[model samples]
Target: MSSKFLFAALGLGFMLASCGNQKSEYDRFYEQDYKDSVSEAVANAPEPAPGTRTPSAPAQQQPAQEVHPGSKLIAGSDCTACHSNQQKLVGPAYVEVAAKYEENDKNREYLIGKILEGGAGVWGQVPMPPHPNLNKDDAGKMVDYILSLNN
Candidate 1:
């Protein structure tokens, strides 16, 4: 009887542990997207004219970082596992991609397709894994962010 009780307790404990307070993947992605959107808004906000500042406002406001929506998507997804903005890892650096391809409609479409279909021979032998689950709109956003790095 005691052995049976112990086993039951262990199973209960395992179930409780599995259900512990942890953010779901969607929750994490949503939070990151919200944060990035706010940052982008702040970054794009026009500064007040020199004489228009209220006395109560701080003398100097640091420039807000311009975060792209795609950056959040990339962060939330598995892209960062192999790629980075500044340096190459398992894949080419995002900056390199930007440098290679000028931002244009044709390039954008091509890149979006590449993201969905995956490819190799362009960035060396290691093939880029396809993201069948990611939609074209999201892929285009990611490409925009990567291409923006050129500037």
Candidate 2:
């Protein structure tokens, strides 16, 4: 009888302990305190001139970053895992790709198809996975950005 009671207690304790660390919907990275702080800051801040930046506001409020438009797509996608601009990663460097193929109409069109369909045995054995949902125009933008990295 004592052994059975011990087993039940241990099981109950384990369940409670596991539940202690579980996060609910309200448990967000940006909590009420963070929202209050941002609201207070915005309320007090003086608006700057149309093109100018405010000195007291956060650094993120400064001039927009000089990153390419395709950079956002690259950041959200798995492209970073295999390709980097200046140096070799899992695949050839973007600069090397730019060197191999000029960014003219021919290469741009070809690369768009490659990016959408995926390719293997072209840049060695590591296969480039297909991005079926990525449209041709966006793929062209990414190709443009990669080609632009030749400098």
| TM-score, per-candidate, Cα-based | 0.57, 0.56
Error of model 2, residue 99, in angstroms = 1.2
Query: Per-prediction count of colliding residue pairs?
Result: 0, 0
Model 2 per-residue lDDT tens digits across residues 41-132: 55555555432324553343224587677766765678877876656777788889988897799999988899999998878998888999
* Superposed model 2: Cα runs more than 4 Å off: 1-63
Candidate 2 colliding pairs: none
lDDT, candidate 1, 65-136, per-residue tens: 655788778867988778877768889999999999999999999999999999999989999999999999
Q: lDDT scores for all predictions?
A: 0.76, 0.70
Stretches of candidate 1 off by over 4 Å are 1-65
Give the range of the ten consecutive residues with the poorest summed lDDT in model 1.
Answer: 55-64
Q: Which pairs in model 1 have colliding backbones?
A: none
**Which TM-score value belongs to model 2?**
0.56
The per-residue C-alpha lDDT of model 1 at residue 62 equals 24
Instruction: Please state every model's RMSD to the true fold in angstroms.
Output: 20.2, 17.7
